[model samples]
Target: METNATTNENLNMYEKAENYTKTSLELIKLKTVSATADVLSTLTSRIAVGAVVAFFTLFLNIGLSLWIGKELGEYYYGFFALAVFYLLVAVILHKTQHKLIKTPIGNMIVSSILKESKN
Candidate 1:
């Protein structure tokens, strides 16, 4: 009878562990989808803002460069400045992407999963 009880307890524990594993996997799937959506939304917003800014900036830069090039009699220098501006924008955006990846939402997902498992 004692052996039977021990065997039954072990079976129960095994079932619980299996269920937990399945639940954890499902949670991971959901988190993956959620994270993707979040990143997409962030990128979309940034792109929308960048589109508007870029439109105006492009025209303004063109006018300014032409004026500067005419005054200095060196169009290549004006073009170089434009290139540097674009490179700076790219660098800033790359940093922003890194920061976003390390955000609270990402941390919360892992922390919540750990908290759930502890329970």
Candidate 2:
């Protein structure tokens, strides 16, 4: 009888431990899902805003190029100048991309994840 009671107690303890582990795992899964959703939402918003800005920039550049062409009496020259400007900007961005963009973005993402974990 004494041995049976001891064995039953051990079984109960094991079951409780298993239950705790399962609950902890579920909580981790939920946190992962929440963090992923938050990141996706942020990225979606950024992409949408970026698309709008790009659309506006395209029209603005065309207007400016045409204006420049009118001023210079050469439409092609205006477009050429705009192209050159963009090329220079692209080069600069390529050279400084890690410093100017990637690190900041990475840090923001990490911080966001950490903040979610804290909450």
Candidate 3:
């Protein structure tokens, strides 16, 4: 009778461990999904805002170029000046892209995930 009771207790312990493991896995999955959704939503909204700003910048630059061209007596010269300015800007960005862009983006993603986990 004592041996049977001991076996039964061990079986119950095993069942409890199994239940705990399953519950832990489910929680992990839920957290992963929540973090992913948070990051994606944040990125989507930023992209939308960026698109609007891009359009505004495009029109503003075009108008400025035309005005500059009128002042210079040739529209193409305005464009050439703008092109040179942008070329310098592009080179600077390329040189510092890892520091300016990649690190910030990586930190943002990590923070988003940590924020979700905390919640």
TM-score-sorted candidate list, best first: 2, 3, 1
Better of 1 and 2 by lDDT: 2
lDDT of 3 by residue, 27-112 (tens): 99999999999999999999999999999989988988888888999998888878888999999999999999999999999999
lDDT of each structure?
0.78, 0.94, 0.95
What is the TM-score of each predicted model, taking all chains together?
0.51, 0.96, 0.94
Q: What is the lDDT of residue 73 in candidate 3?
A: 97
Q: Each model's number of backbone clashes?
A: 0, 0, 0
Output the number of the TM-score-best candidate.
2
What value does the lDDT take at residue 52 in candidate 2? 100
Best of the two (1, 2) by TM-score: 2
Estimate candidate 1's alpha-carbon lDDT, on a 0 to 1 scale: 0.78
For model 1, what is the alpha-carbon lDDT of residue 81?
A: 76
lDDT of 2 by residue, 16-117 (tens): 999999999999999999998898899899999999999999999999999888888999778888999999999999999999999999998998888789
lDDT of 1 at 117: 48
Best-to-worst lDDT order: 3, 2, 1
Q: TM-score of predicted model 2? A: 0.96
**How displaced is residue 40 in candidate 3, in Å?**
0.4
